[model samples]
Target chain A: MMILGPAHASPENIATMRELMGLDHSIPVQFIHYMGQLLKGDLGYSYHAGSPVSQELLRRFPATFELTTFAFVLMVLCSLPLGVVSGYYRNKTPDNVISVFTVMGLSMPTFWFGLLLIYIFFYKLGLAPPPMGRLSPDVAFPPRVTGLLLVDTLLNGDLKAFLSAFHQLILPGVTLAFFNLAIIVRTLKADLIETLEEDYIRTARAMGIGVKKVLLRHAFRNALLPTVTMIGAIYGSLLGGAVLTEVVFSWPGVGMYAVQSIRYLDYAGLQGFIIFYVIIFALITLLVDISYRWIDPRVQLD
Target chain B: MKEVLLEIRNLQTHFKTDEGEARAVNGVDLKVPKGETLGLVGESGCGKSVTALSIMRLVPEPPGRIIGGEIIFDGQDILKLREAEMRRMRGNTLSMIFQEPMTAMNPVYRIGSQMAEVIQLHQKVSKKEAMDRALDMLHKVGIPDPKQRLREYPHQISGGMRQRVLIAMALSSHPKMVIADEPTTALDVTIQAQILDLMNQLKEEMGTSNLLITHDLGVIFEMAQWVAVMYAGKIVEYAAVSDLFSQPLHPYTTGLMNSIPQIDQPVPKDKMLRSIPGMVPSLFDLLEGCTFQDRCNHVFDRCRREEPGLADLGSGHMVRCWLHG
Candidate 1:
């Protein structure tokens, strides 16, 4: 029904368009027909973009990858020390202060936080470039090397373009990282507190290991086991384009492509997006499973 | 008199629970002699473990703390040492073996790295040297194929093997004192004896003073040269092991000894197996006099009015009861 727009075209016109697109067949026939097309690596046609869905996905993949990678790196760098310190000195000053920010990070929606950053850094202070996409329209595109603008510009020895691209990434990257950081730290801190209570930790301390070794080597590694599962799940979503953060920053990533596909009733495009998400999610689950073996030997025993 | 190794004078450790401050170790005093095993026997929650932990200075703070008194170990006041000094002394001068061997080791680490880490911490040894020392310790503990055992995770080994690994870790530094808190409690009965035997053999070989805390009278009788019976966070009786058993004084001590199920001495058909009546008193609302007054069959007016101090009964036998005094 939504396939036809508000102009309310005649039934005859709808039938002709349907036949032209081969949608006139029964459901099973259409599925089998679509599978045959899929065998050739075709992800169907996107009426919304007027291009093949796979081509659109490939083009947007680099933008999403760069954004998620930056955000993930930021999350890891900030959360590990923050979580360990918060837990080691648990219920004390540093923990209390860190907890307050983490709670706020968890509470605020990604879209709202992204907008807030934009309001402060972009509108009020004029510190951020406009949230209008990857780069300013006036800047010439650097020669494609890695497909990530940050790397491609640096590869071309274009510092000016590198700075501009990095500026565009900052708000969204932070916005994406904040929520992920909140999850990881909360997980790590809680688990660390519990792990510290384990008999092994007390034994470790009694055996005269230094403060740093006891905390980091014994307690931290045990604590990180539970948090690894949380990180894997967060990673899969972040890799799938962090939908709300992408839309808020107007980063022309796969998430925007997905949103447009839905609004325009582009079923083929949506199907392709779902397929990509599942494949990435499966790979991430495998990585998490492998990590369990490395970090926790009892994984098999339990 | 053997030279004193570890002496505790009026050690008071308290825990802040929601109910109130739990006076876990209340005015406890005891001494361990060089190259001798002092068995600490008590009912569960009688501060035997707390006493052991206090000596290690590993009591969890905020909730648990050594609020008063001094612990002098090897001529140094343990409580007076700086944090760094205490750390150096740990696993070097003072080491501990915990109750639950199953959970006492880091499950994620190889037995080798975990043992090597403790050895390396107190000594300025390279990693390979530390590991060699670890391998030697494992061999000393009589673990079969010590080299291969070191590479295995804690769970891959049996509960008995884990306990042996713990013993190896505890003694790797040749500390001045080793506190074994029910080290074999979690293992099978057969394994328990083996572990205890291993500990005794090692203690004899190393001449490391041992503070063995256990609820089992038999274990105390077998392993300890001297025994201290604890009741409600204080030593109710202290004596040479043979003297304590032959003439068990403290009503609490007699009660514990009687409570042990006997195989050779059968109960009369009409008689029930003896057990101490009443529960250990709540540390939260401790009575004014003796903490055990409510549970003591020999309770009297003085016992209700004021607690008795441990009075020496000659030749190192002491009993904290009015009858003995």
Candidate 2:
């Protein structure tokens, strides 16, 4: 508010700001005004967006949500099985091969990888249509149901739009997933290997529990506790990584909206996105905590 | 006549380390009758625990090879059995209570869940039925409020409680034999006595045979019917506990008795405690003569030149020393 206000230092503007903040009155008065405004659903207008704060947020939120979810699904599909196999085979060829790929994914920057992917798939192979808006202009977009393009397309029973949307999503989502896949795989592998070496795992073996059961039941759940924290951290981390992905793919999502807000100095849009993500990251962290307790009975917070 | 549940004949478990083969359990021969308690007494690294692992087939393969000998357990040569068949026999026919109860049980799981899993693996029972059996075993092991206690995790309970829980789980399947590897060593004196008393009472009530492995002579004297004194991975003396203690034929066995603090004999405070000098020989070094020869005070030319086979003079007394002839 201070940065964008042209007459922020002017005596009149300063007085007006102070009155709006209720600073001219008592401290309790200002707190009440803040609470009242928050409760009513008035987020205040955007000098940059030029639309109601909520409407602009509502408009940009779907795009970001759609992109992140796609990337998350991609991460899970690749990392989980790879991690299991790597830990199971451990020092063998399978582990070696997976380790190589994981190292490659981890070492390469996500933005660099995104650009590389765009160059290969879009520019060279010409497999995907040149990365641009959510849907190509020639294809008529379906009626918005949930505001999520994929869901909206599916809801309208427009398979063509859904297929097209998915194809466009693949490169960006896979690129975003690369680094995350490396992280989850590394976490799962390290934890699983460590858990396997534990005396309980030896006890499990002594009790004649099968290797599969020992790995899946005895080791896997315990292994996932650390991975849950990793996932929660990634939930926030993905926001940053997604910016590069969104820019490269041109898929309209939170990251893309955020960059556009910063460039245009859309304070209301940027604030809305930031606040929305704080809530998101908090909720993800909460979910991780709950799941950790669910997975292992021994972890109890005093 | 009691039925012999296990007759381990000349069992030798060797680990092939980078240096050489380390025989953890070398040519150990013993027998335990059903419902009887046979105490295996040894110093650390003397193969008492290794023998227990061999009985359950829990020894790590590759580096650890049984080498030669037959672990005839429950009328089957466990060494000859396939991995799957051996696994089937482990919890149902033969179960083990490890020394460190804390590490023995999975900390992440509640005691009940782990116990129920062992029960369900062996029996085709419902989860509810398995849980009931777990609670029943917990009750038998003298745990208060078996149902509520079953829900408590290992860490939530004390070390003593964890041992009781492990004992309860081991006894749940009505295993023909239980191998306890220094089960009370980790507990304090009070808890140790409690666990020992509980084990004896439970064993008598269930009529389950036990292989009690420990270095504590006091515990061996208290609970063991037959005693086997192991030295350097070999049983130096094997006889009824009364006979073995009365006439300890092996020098190592006699030395061990002298080392244990006795209430009857009062020694001067400043006087050093009796100890058998010299460290246990490394497993990588093959014993050309007797493994205990270097440490034995009665070491003679024969003791240095040749190893002694377990020789029986009369009755059931057996000793592996040249002087025993």
Candidate 3:
């Protein structure tokens, strides 16, 4: 619709677009042709990029994947311990402080938060690298081993390049992760509080199990079920948030590519990006469902 | 007389609630002799469960607390012991079987792992050795196909089976005293009987003293040798189970016995089943005089003005009432 809607108005591309839209063939035939092309890994050409949409996607996707992966790791590492502490010391001073921070995190706009972080770390403190691209302007691109800049740099055995890449990643990675971390912590804390009240927790305590074992083995394991589901839900939206984050950081990722494609009326590039996002989201949902059974034996997958 | 395994002197446990301070266990004194079941019987909210939890030092803090008391078990004042020391005492010298077996054991873990964890927590044993002990305990609890049952989660088992597993876990360590808080309340009548029988048999086998908390007089009659009748957070009556049944001195005990339907003796068609009038007094607003005076039939001037203490009547039978005094 997007392609046809624009193509119908353009005088020059109209003839070629109509031919590509299968004006000579029946609708079912056109549908089948489209499916065949999709199945054969052909997403058509992006006129904006002056290349195939699939090739453009392949080039940009690794950056977004790497950024999202780093952000996700940061979210889990930061949120789990914070959530556990907050929930364990519920209604206390620490919990109150964390609650305020999380509320601010949840309410604050992602773009605004990204700008604020950049202002603090880059401008005020001058601790962070500039919000440019995935690597410094001066450094040449490392050998593409896994396509992740960090991995590729480390694999190339260039510690200096790896360190510089890591520095460039921190701001954007934290910007993408902060909101997700807040969400995870809040949900995890709520789940942990409920889990702590379960009769089995009392049973664990009654069995002379120490505080740490009771929290980690019994309470936290059970609490993680809901948090895992939350992660899957949050991860899909994180991609959406990544667009603004990428724009703010000026990071070369699929989100920025999609934004430029939309601005330039690159219909094929936009369609390809949507499809890829859906596929990744679906895969993550499947992984979360499988993890539920692992975390809670009572949850039967079948 | 048997040696005292657990001694409570003026034990008081209160809860700070929005309404007021709920005197859950108010200055209650009791004793459980070694290898004997001491039944603490009362209606709901009579502090039977609180007393049991107090003995285990498992009362939920902030809201519930032991204000003033000495719970001397195995020659140590548990209240005086540090948190770490108290933890060691739990599942080692003292273990507890909760009321609801269905939700008592963790649903996520297998029965064997939960049982084995308890063993490993208290004893210096390898995982394999602990697992072997768990299997042995499961067999002792009369669970069919013990090997398979050990690997199954709590939800996979029946209510009766879960209670049996709880019994096995509680007794696995052979603790000096086991606090069974209404252990058979959530089971069917037949299952209740089976569990009660198993507990009694296990108690005899292990020679472990039990502080059985229940509302059922029938359960007390079957399981307990020493009976403590509680009324609104105080032990209003203490006596041998047989003596208490034969000669209930406290008005509350009399009301309890009278309320129990006699199956063999047919009731008159016109007469309704006798129920104790009024309700258990709220612990939050306890009266200055007797806690049970509002419900007692034998209320007099002294009963309304001054509270009566537990008066000895003979043969170790005691009753807290103006009539007894």
What TM-score should be assigned to candidate 2? 0.86
Which candidate leads in lDDT?
1
Give model 2's docking category. acceptable
DockQ of each: 0.87, 0.46, 0.73
lDDT for each candidate structure: 0.90, 0.82, 0.87
Question: lDDT tens digits, residues B1-325, model 2?
Answer: 2688899999999988888888888899998988999999999999998899888887777668788899888788889999889888777878888888877778778888998998899999999999999988898888888889888888888889988988887777888898998999999999999999998998898888999999988899899888999988899899988998888989899989888887777885875468888888877776688888878888889887888999987777889999886
TM-score per candidate, in order? 0.95, 0.86, 0.94
The residue pairs that clash in candidate 3, if any, are none
Q: By TM-score, is 1 or 2 better? A: 1
The interface RMSD for candidate 1 is 0.7
> By lDDT, is 1 or 2 better?
1
* Candidate 1 local lDDT, A216-291, one digit each (tens): 9999989998898888888888887678888898888988889989889899999988888877888897899888
Model 1 C-alpha lDDT per residue in residues B1-325, reported as the tens digit of each score? 5999999999999999988899999999999999999999998998999999899888888789999999999998989999999988888878899999999999889999998888878888999999999999999998999999989999999989889999999999898789999988889999999998998988899899999999999999889999999988999999999999999998999999888878898785866678889999987778988778888999999998887899998999989998777
**Model 3: how far residue B77 lies from native, Å:** 2.0
Chain B TM-score for the candidates in order: 0.98, 0.96, 0.98
Superposed model 1: Cα runs more than 4 Å off: A1-13, A35-41, A154-157, A300-302
RMSD to the true structure for each prediction, in A, is 2.2, 4.8, 2.9
Which ranges of candidate 2 are over 4 A from the true structure?
A: A1-58, A115-129, A142-145, A258-283, B1-3, B16-20, B268-272
